[model samples]
Target: MTQRPVSNPAPANNPAPAYNPALSGNPQSATGRAYPNGNPDLGYNPPGVRNTDSAVPLRRDKPVIHNYACKDAAPGNLAFRWTYGSNVAAKNRDPRVQVVQYNEDSFVLRQNVCVHWEAPFTYLLFGNKGALLIDSGATADAQHYPLRATVDAIITRWAQARGRRAVPLTIALTSGEDVAQNQGLVQFAGRPETTIVPKPLHVMKRFYGLANWPSGTGAIDLGDRVIEVIPTPGTHQDGVSFYDPYCDFLFTGDLLFPGKINIGNDRDFVASLERLKAFAADRPVKWLLGGHIEMMFVPGKYYPRFATYKPYERVLEMLPAVIDEAIQYARDVQGKDMMLIRPDFALFNGVSPDQRTQVWPVGVPNINAPRPF
Candidate 1:
């Protein structure tokens, strides 16, 4: 008998068409094209980065998927009222980070079309004394990502808003050291005020106060705000997840994204989920924001693999309840067999040590690039 994919009985949040594996993640389809349906103007075509109208007025049949993530309704002031406007700006005008003011002191810096196609997201959160930046883009080259400049601009703006000069900014990685998010190290080499959390396990162990290497927990302070850092190493050897207290949001990097979730260590990944479940018991989590969203129009419909343009993207947030599903499905599948593809996330099969450093399509710069910082 052939093994089958396991999913929840309660129908997917996105409209059906049901599940079709062929178009979701079979290499070519993994990075497939998901053009913008409403208007062609916002297509993410390199020189002129593509974007969707903040008020996309999505097709009636295709209701807002986020509204369905939870039934009880979202928490107070935790909504993403933002609209993602068109991306018709000139090529030279595009910056590596598409900065969106999310909250009073919270800003989201999404990677641009000109940078890595993965188009990973990094966040800048500000408090009284300083701020925290999560994840560098796919490259450290200032010409490419220019993450440091963007941060500097934001700091200046923030200082001006508060009638004060800029404070120190800390650059941190999720679940730690996944190469796709660490190319910006060189850009901040000489900055005296910026404190980038080192990626090595030893350094992380000390920084996070994790006497335990793979599973340690610590707190990160951004002035008046404090975020929890939990070591979740299955996604990568040094993977870690950060929690924001003010908004009751959890910023999990690739660990909880909508796209391909490749697990490097099975034990660590499952344990991380359990850790999250326990952590949530105390904190009132409003929204669980993740690193990437590869799915498009329909349910389980993902964009092509390695493609820089994600024209038909889903909402960037997921309900905290999905964590329970992820944890349960991860446990259910493991009890039956080796690796199983769960509904929300995948329980990736463990890989060899040599294979850990290698990513598909071979030799991709973001995957293979050497990090000197």
Candidate 2:
């Protein structure tokens, strides 16, 4: 009567079975009638209802080539200021060594002028295998300069940054005879995993594989990076120059600096300049970095020897064209022993090696007073 003859009647407490499109294998229809909404449990998309969401196509299945090899020498910048010396009275505030990162893999460190008036610049270049330190600096006392410890810390930090436990250090010099450069060599003595190239002329030449020194070239491979060593014996008998193809930088040490150039052998000096000029002619030379800066910003002017506070000191970098000027100057003063003043650098031929143009009344800069420009 009410249900027009019920085929199957459920108990009062029992519920009827729900419709399932999945069991019937037809998501759109339940038994016979079509369903308005697609069955989510059956993983069915509604007909004529395209998904509006944007999608990216699947990438092609292929073996990806991962590059683990080291890259080529990348260019870096040197546009930052250096740490010049301050008054001796306030020397406590100055750092023993001023380290400037030219790039992630290269660093330039300078000795504080107050620690030693020379304030020579040292270079630290990193390679995958090891590291190369160009110069130790002017001071021998670790308490004063701390060259070895500073270098070690730098190496440790560099290694840690690359997920390494330790990295070896190779210490080389531009001129082993120059006290201002080799004085700190003693500090690196007995350092583990550190190779200090012998400061002696013959030994250093042999270490770099410069059998035909003063003529042939040598190389130091720091894994991927290579440092070219050129025999430059004019500034000193053991004088050498470093050329970094990566940076296009020629580190001339005392051979060609912004300050006084004391020529140990005028003949050797001249020949070396010619060689450097020729080398720079074919290659791209960005800057010629030297060990020290003695000249002021003014052309043909330099601070006296042992002068500590140099506020108006000239920049440390020199151009390759200066090599041309250096050749001309060397030629003009070839046979003479005199001081030649120029804008970029001063030449001292046949003079005292430690001689300076400016004469200090007290033989040292008066740190209490302002430096005379």
Candidate 3:
């Protein structure tokens, strides 16, 4: 689905709003100002911004951007969602660009670019045996700062980190949402020699057809690390999950998030979550890497605010609830009802009524059980 660009509406006739210096730098003040605990107006403050005094300087050698926009329909509901908090630190603390380290075998490196906003995308360089990248940012408009430069820098840095040698890099998709994979391929295309593994057929056929695309589920075995692609349908037919056995990490593209799951594609969303749960049950998923949020699943903790139910032995634990929610929503409201009640169905209005009828099982009479996947 093509995302409509958020046109920066011209400033209102009223005098320009005063710049909150707190919003810019002061960590404590910014935290309070952005999220005043129980206040409805204050949204979620991005991670690292809450404690600014301890803010680590961004790696200067690389460009970075941070965004803090809430994912829910209600702008104020910031908790458990991902958002941009502050710009990247000016200095390079570690040139290695390790965003999060799961264990001795695995580590994640994040690229710096774009300030916080809707649909923020970050590049993750995963190192197992060889190197693999999860999701590329949207690069439709060259005018947009950092989006282009940020991705380019990451590609360069990733190569350099690998000693600029000819290393095979595989691109994995969480969802084919433009932000996650669009610009990512464009940037990688610049490096002709680098081995680019195409996403699996199940995902690609649904969102983007085989137009100027590569073939097969490109698997890379980098000695100690092995990256394999698994199809995760539901959120988007093209959605995929990456499993790194060396690190025991599962990059759940967009199947899950810290807070609410974006089951915009309801049926697949539930199924995708179920798939992840089943995988987690058998494997050691120490880290649930999210394309959007900094952390989605932290072991042994109930992230109720993010709609995470307990006893999360597998991805299925969250599925029944999400399916129930979507099914209930379809039953509760009129197909034409518009107050934008649910996030999953918000985009429903954007599509044709016929499409809505096809997608939503809600309001349909005698729909006994939830729609089967």
- Using TM-score as the measure, the top candidate is 2
Best by lDDT: 2
lDDT of 2 by residue, 201-316 (tens): 88888888888878888988887678888899987888889988777789999999998898878889999999998888877788999999988876666788877788888889
Which residue pairs show backbone clashes in model 2?
none
The sequence of per-residue lDDT tens digits that candidate 1 reaches over residues 161-218 is 4556447888888844677788776688889788988878788789879896655579
Please write out the lDDT profile of model 3 over residues 215-278, one tens digit for every residue.
2233445544456556565545666777665545566655554333334455554555555556
Which regions of candidate 1 fall more than 4 Å away from where they truly are?
1-95, 214-216, 332-347, 350-373
TM-score between model 2 and native: 0.75
In candidate 2, clashing pairs total 0
Ten residues in sequence with the least summed lDDT for candidate 1: 59-68
In candidate 2, position 157 carries an lDDT of 68
| Global Cα lDDT for candidate 2 | 0.76
Comparing 1 and 2 on lDDT, the stronger one: 2
Better of 1 and 3 by lDDT: 1
Query: What TM-score against the true fold does each predicted structure earn?
Result: 0.68, 0.75, 0.45
Arranged by lDDT with the best first, the candidates are 2, 1, 3
lDDT of 1 at 144: 69
How accurate locally, in lDDT, is each candidate? 0.63, 0.76, 0.40
lDDT of 3 at 246: 50
